[model samples]
Target: MKTTAIGYSENLPAAHPEALLSREVPVPEPGPRDLLVEVEAVSVNPVDVKLRAGAPADGFRVLGFDAAGTVRAVGAEATLFAPGDEVFYAGSIGRPGTNQRLHLVDERIVGRKPTALSFADAAALPLTAITAWEALFDRLRLEEDSAGTLLVIGATGGVGSVMLQLAEALLPDVAVIATASDDARAARMRELGAEHVVNHREDLVAQVLEIAPEGVDRLFTAHSEGQIERYAEIVRPFGHVVAIDDGPRDVSPLKGRSISWHWELMFTRPLLETPDMIEQHRLLDAVADLVDRGRIRSTAATVLGPISPAALREAHELVERGRTVGKVVVHGWEEAIDSARESTDIY
Candidate 1:
């Protein structure tokens, strides 16, 4: 049952050698409806950095969400996938993460990997795509007939990048006003299908208002920290606002206009084992269809080389800095990663 994994027993800085330690850990026995997979690639998210820096661990807590891999075995009750099937998933927060060479995930929450993409590329889509899809369709209730301005507050990160494409592909008639800080990011927003690109550094209200005179119908914020006030101002009366970050959300400022605030966490279904837990599998398959049909693309902008302690630490550093352009990923469990950094590297 032993397998290769990288984890952190202590909350240390990414530069520290012990931030992520490689070790042989006991791989859990597959529960019924579980698929045991050999991980091929993984992408880093902000959740990984937050837990690594703050969440205390007993021995070593493996922290990863997005993974693309092939099924090695299936539990007795698992019928959705079989051995050798390529799949991608954002694992349940209740279980051990996908950072290890072998991982166990419920088949209901896993989807077939997009045949058009490599493992690393497919790995980047699950978490972000699921978040965006849930935010737009489930929380915000953006339907095909729903028409109004959709303003994306932070439109350059992994979630924002995929959100724009989903909005464009799903709601073709809806105008999208995306916010970015710099010229390069603004250009990227346009390329990804934002009808109007504004600068987040400047006055978001004024810039967004110029595009939509009344106000944006809905707002999706990837970072929800200090942006709630801005959300109250830019969003239209009786409009909807959906956010994905975790923090204080005092919506007193939004009550005047009756602007409803909603929160989205992609892990909710799998974490609670909800009746609709299989929705993730369906949506991921839909996203895979979109990818194959050339309607959308992966948000993996940076690949850190391999699945090792050194590469994961570097990826965490980039994510913690809060400036990663898109999802950061590491592919392949090659031996070179172990010998790359003398004291810091772990396989």
Candidate 2:
């Protein structure tokens, strides 16, 4: 059988109208410990833009990571889920992504979809939620009940939106100070439980210091272009800092203050095939529970209609601009079942 998909054969900027293309690809069969998912909804992320810009020129690169779908088949060794189970996951960077109608993902990296959310809403959580959960609890080693100040830079973006709520729910005693340049974004962050909101366009140090004179105890940076060094100055001695974006950086300043810099990539475990790969499954399950219990909400702010090349390209453009407040999702295949069956299929 085959499935409809949107992908690219060449690395073109999102500015090009042909950057993404709609095609039909063979439905991938599950490997041991994998699940064949009939994708229901998918969300765009910054990583999707980055990967598409550098996609290989030979084979098409399907560029989606966050997906919510139902299990259609399971690998011989897969025991976590069976056919018809609703699941969500951030697929590995090593495989064909979740942009297709049928996707095969390791069961170890998949979790039960949130009961309270539609597939589109559940689709928005995996990548950002896993990134935030690992960045705070694993990389920063923040205690669940600890009392300290956490300054989240770029606090209204997809990851930041979920991070704010997770920090508030998991670290109840900690003061959450989020940075948003505009009043609307600031208000959104506050609504997500940020105790304080500061303008990132202004002097970050001054704004943070005004709230916590002693300096923030931890820093989670979702956007750090030329401001990495500033984190060293504003973070308290021995404080931890986690960054998700990739760029050339000078961390020499952090050493003098005894501050530690950590990098977080949600794909790390599956990309490396680590022994702890199953941790993603556990984390996603916990996040699903949180969402169901109303401890956290879906961060999907835009729904770009059905999964088609045109819709996906529009979503890509929005993400590439770096101005979207929350996650953007696309639901279901655009083509009718008969049309999809008649389309050319690439193996």
Candidate 3:
């Protein structure tokens, strides 16, 4: 059997409309501990853009990270999920991605879908939510009772949207200050739970200092244009800063201030096959519970039709423009399901 997927034939720029195309490939079978998911929805992320631009010339390179779907089959050792389970996950970079009808992902990296959201909405949460959660709690070691100011750069983008809300929900004592370029973006940041929204277009150090005179205790940068020097200046001595962007940056300025720099990549565990890989499953499950309890809402701001090559290309274009306020999602498959066995799972 074959599955429909969207992929790139060459490393072409997003402006080239022919960069992405739909094609059929043989459906893959599951290995031990894998779940063969029938993809229902997917969200376009910055990683997708980078991968598409750098795609190999020899063959199609499938490029997606966030996905929500139903389990069509499970490997023998995959005890976490059975056939017909509703799930969401950011599949590993080492494997073929979720921009296809059938995707095989390790069950350890998947989570039960949030009962409160649609497939498209749930699809938006996995990658960004995991990044934000790991950045705050794991890298920064932030606690619920931690006191002092926290500065979030790029406060209205996909990762920033979820990070802001998670900070407010998880760290009640910490003051959440965000940086945005315009009034509209700043207001949207505030709506997401930022206590202070400063303009990033201006001197970020000065703007942050005006609100936090002593400097912030923790900093999280979702997107930085070589702003490590600015971060080093605005963060207090011995403060912690986490960055998730793949852009080149200089961290030498942070040495003088004794500030600690760390990186958060949501794919690390799955890619490395770490012993603690199951932590992603646990974290995602917790996030889903929070969403169900109304503590956090889906950050899906744009829904761009079904998961086809054309729709996915448009979604990638929006994300590449770098001004999207929240997550962009594409739901459903291009093909219709003819059997009840494939359509019964709903969470």
Candidate 4:
């Protein structure tokens, strides 16, 4: 087996946009209940870019969220994954991540890969899918399976893109009203199963009313700040709104509608070492089922080359630019190949 893995490195904060390097490091070992994944593909998120641009003064911070890979090994206590399962997951924010050739992830947070999708497409789903799933199901506290209109704030982003599909898969009869600032994005939202496409650049209230007229029952905000106050105005009395983005502003606007506001961070359970961290595993597995059954489609729109500092930096730049419509993935690494070879030998 290989002794080291390849990954991107950020040594210091960048005042401008040039402070990432690619290098090799020792391959990580799996702890109890963890799986050593041979990453086949990976995707970047906004958190990756922000953390890198404003990185803390430390050794280095490995930044990556979504990944699809084969399991190379399993910790003693790990029951779900073995040596050769194809899996996908949005690993913990508390540890070194999938930017490298091999990554150690808690088995409870990982899931079987969808047989229908390729590694790149599967890579796009994990982070965004988990974020969307938790926001709609966990934080919002919607029924395990129910139907109602769900308003998505930023439908073109990685999270919003997958969220739309999950909503559609879970509740096929429900109306999905998505907000996209432009025509291209609106089309993309529709492709993902949004019944109505509204413009966030205009009055959300007026635009939403034109479709439903009554009001939305649930609202999910995917982009950052400024729209909380607006969402508060449009949601029906006692409706729920869940936000994954951060803002320090007062949340008092929700008081008027008696609306419920939720903050969703996919990393919460893993980061805090919560008791129910395994729920992520369950949800991810459920997502895999939906994908394999052809109920939810992967939202990976673009595929880049092999994982490297330059490619990773470019991926981060795409997120920062706000023009990307769906998730982008990078594949090709020794870890994935080794895992495949081991699987063949065992078979």
Order the candidate numbers by TM-score, best to worst.
1, 2, 3, 4
Better of 1 and 2 by lDDT: 1
Q: Per-residue lDDT tens digits of candidate 4, residues 101-172?
A: 788999988999999999899998998888988888788776646777889887888888888888777777
Summing lDDT over every window of 10 consecutive residues in candidate 4, give the lowest-scoring window. 7-16
Which is the winner by lDDT between candidate 2 and candidate 3? 2
Query: How good is model 2 by TM-score?
Result: 0.95
Measured against the true structure, the TM-scores of the candidates, in listed sequence, are 0.95, 0.95, 0.94, 0.90
Q: How many clashing pairs per prediction, in order? A: 0, 0, 0, 0
**What is the lDDT of every predicted structure here?**
0.90, 0.89, 0.88, 0.80
Q: What digit string (tens of lDDT, one per residue) describes model 1 on residues 1-347?
A: 69998889999998898899998988878899999999999999988988898998777888898999999999999998999999999998888899999999999999999999999999999999999999999998888877888988788988889999998889988899898999999999999999999988888788887888788899888777877787777888999988888745477888999998899999999999999999999999999999999989999889977799999999998888888888899998876456556547453
lDDT for predicted candidate 1 compared with the true structure:
0.90
Q: Cα RMSDs of all predictions? A: 3.8, 4.2, 3.3, 4.0
lDDT-better candidate, 3 vs 4: 3
Off by over 4 Å in 4: 1-18, 334-347
Taking the tens digit of each residue's C-alpha lDDT, what string does model 2 give over 98-178? 998999999999999999999999999999999999999889888877898999998888888999999888999999999
- Residue 90 displacement (Å), model 3: 0.7
